[model samples]
Target: MTYTIGFLGTGNIAADMARALNGSGHKILVSQRNAKTAAALAAAMPEVTIAPNETVVANADILFLCLLARTAAQVLPGLPFRADQTVISVMVDMPLARLRSLCAPATDIVLTIPLPPIAQGGCPLPVFPDCPALHRLFGDRNLILPQPSETALNAHLAASAICATLLDQMMTTADWLAAFTGDDDAAQAYVAAMIRGYLSDRPRPGALPAALRGLSTEGGLNATLRAAMAPAKDSLRNGLDGFRPRLGLPLGPEP
Candidate 1:
């Protein structure tokens, strides 16, 4: 099936999802906000259409609530939603319960976190619990990481923030290496491949340190780099520690 998907916002990420699903045989309907973006997406994808904001909500079988965090409250109540529709929220830090209360009570509200790379089919798509509809939409294209409970969702939120932090640091390092080494493309490619390999080979449970144990070898490049990155990693750990209380999530056992 061809499901009617209504997108409530016209942000970059929202447009990216629309592009990812382009020509997938599904009908894509976008709200009349950010007229320029909506028009562009509609033009690019034959299946995409620009409808009045209210009309999109009422007509869509599945709603993608991509509104900005600041304005979702003001915009949500005004949309005409159907009782049996499935509403999937992409806004961060918004609880599922709050989303349920804001939308039509009969609709199933699910919270999801979608990274920018979804346009390239590499998104770290995180969803709460299980929903067959969501499974059909994103299960094939992205790494669908589902959390078991609200506590798990909070951890996922922290993970999302950590992803941004890590990416920023990685990009900055790549830029610095490019500037000093006079090989921008090579620097970025090297860093990207390094991180990908590291993540792919990461060990589980107590095996993590063992996996990284080779780094402590005497006078090695890895040892030198680990020393340089130690303070930054410690600071990140402290920041994550502070976030746990704010998220109301239990702390993992101390090592």
Candidate 2:
């Protein structure tokens, strides 16, 4: 079914969603708060209309809250949100109780984390409370991982924070390859393709450990490199563990 989806904030996330939802038969209404992004989206997707937040909220069947936490706190209360409309929030660190309070009268509120890759589809969307609206809208292109609880969803959000660090490491590897091969573009392409291929080849559960074990051949370069990077891996684990308290998860068992 088609939806009149409105974006409350026209930031990068909003832009990406607009791109993803383009041609989905949904009437997309994006707020004019971020003028540049909203304009760009309207320009790129001629079907998307730029409107004031009030108009967007009033006309939309489903609204996506893509604003910064502070901006949301300042803006949401003033908007006219209908009780029948569905509201999905992508605001990081915003608690669900606070959101529900701010978006009162609109009882169908969903919390979800959508990555930038959502623009091109195939991104994993971690959602709380198992929203059917989300599945109906994005399930065709993305993986909708429904969490058992808000805490589980928050943990997924915390885990997603590691994406930047992983990308940084990929870039570093690409730079090293470029230094050796004298071909920057080729180095980047090769590194990206390598990672993509590896991931695509093992897209099933338990594939990670199996892949690691397979690659760790005795006396091989893979084993040597894996051993050398053991500390970095440990650091990644420690970093995730550190987020437990902040995400309301208890400390894991002692290692």
Candidate 3:
């Protein structure tokens, strides 16, 4: 079945989703709040339509709120919706209860988070998969995940810090290797391959720690670097510890 999906915001995240849905046999209705983005999307995908925000909400069967947390509060209160309309929220760090309160009386409200890689059909979308609409949208790429309590979700938000932190470290390592070898392209290629291999080949849950444990093989060169990096890893733990209290969760015992 072709679903008519309404996008309440046309930001980068929304655009990425639109690109994925383009020519996928889904009807897309885009909001006019971001006129340039909406027009661009409509131009790129002939099936997408540029409509006023209110009209888009009224016409489409499924509504996706892709706005920032602060903006969502202001926009949701003023928007039009029906009791039968299905709603999905993509805003990070916003609790499910808050979303339910804001969008109550809808047919169903789903809380979800997708990484930016959805455009390339590579995102491991974590969502409350109870809703059929979410199931259809995610297709086979989704990880069927239960919505953790708000506290757990907050912790996972901190977990996202690891991605940027690791990527930056990889980039620096690539640059350092380039300096030593005087071959920039080769250095980047090598680092890229290492990252892809590590991610693709690793086992789940204990994979990262297992890789680190392997580095400690009866005291080797990698073991020395692992010892040196202990302080940096501790700093990361401390940073996440500090964030817990800010979100009203107990700091607990620091790692």
Per-candidate TM-scores read: 0.87, 0.95, 0.87
Question: 11-119 in candidate 1: lDDT tens per residue?
Answer: 7878988888977899999987889999999889999999988888888888888998668888888577778898888886567777877786545878787777787
> Model 2: per-residue lDDT, tens digit, 49-143?
99999999998999999999998999999789999999999988688899989998998998999999999898899898889989988899899
User: By the lDDT metric, which is better: model 1 or model 3?
Assistant: 1
**Which candidate should be chosen as best, given TM-score against the real structure?**
2
lDDT of 3 by residue, 1-255 (tens): 888999988988888888878677888998886888888998889989988888878877889888898988887775677788888878875667777777766647776666667776756555563567877876655454555555655565667667788888888999999999999889989998977876642238988777767667766887877787889988988887878875546667643
Which runs in model 3 stand beyond 4 Å of their true positions?
Answer: 201-206, 245-250, 253-255
True-structure lDDT of candidate 3: 0.76
- Which ten residues in a row are the worst by lDDT in model 1? 199-208
User: How far out, in Å, is residue 90 in model 3?
Assistant: 1.3
Q: Give every collision pair in model 1.
A: none
Q: On a 0 to 100 scale, what is the lDDT of residue 172 in model 2?
A: 96
Evaluated at residue 255, the lDDT of candidate 2 is 34
How well does candidate 3 match the true structure in TM-score terms? 0.87
Q: What is the C-alpha lDDT of each candidate?
A: 0.80, 0.89, 0.76
lDDT, candidate 1, at 181:
92
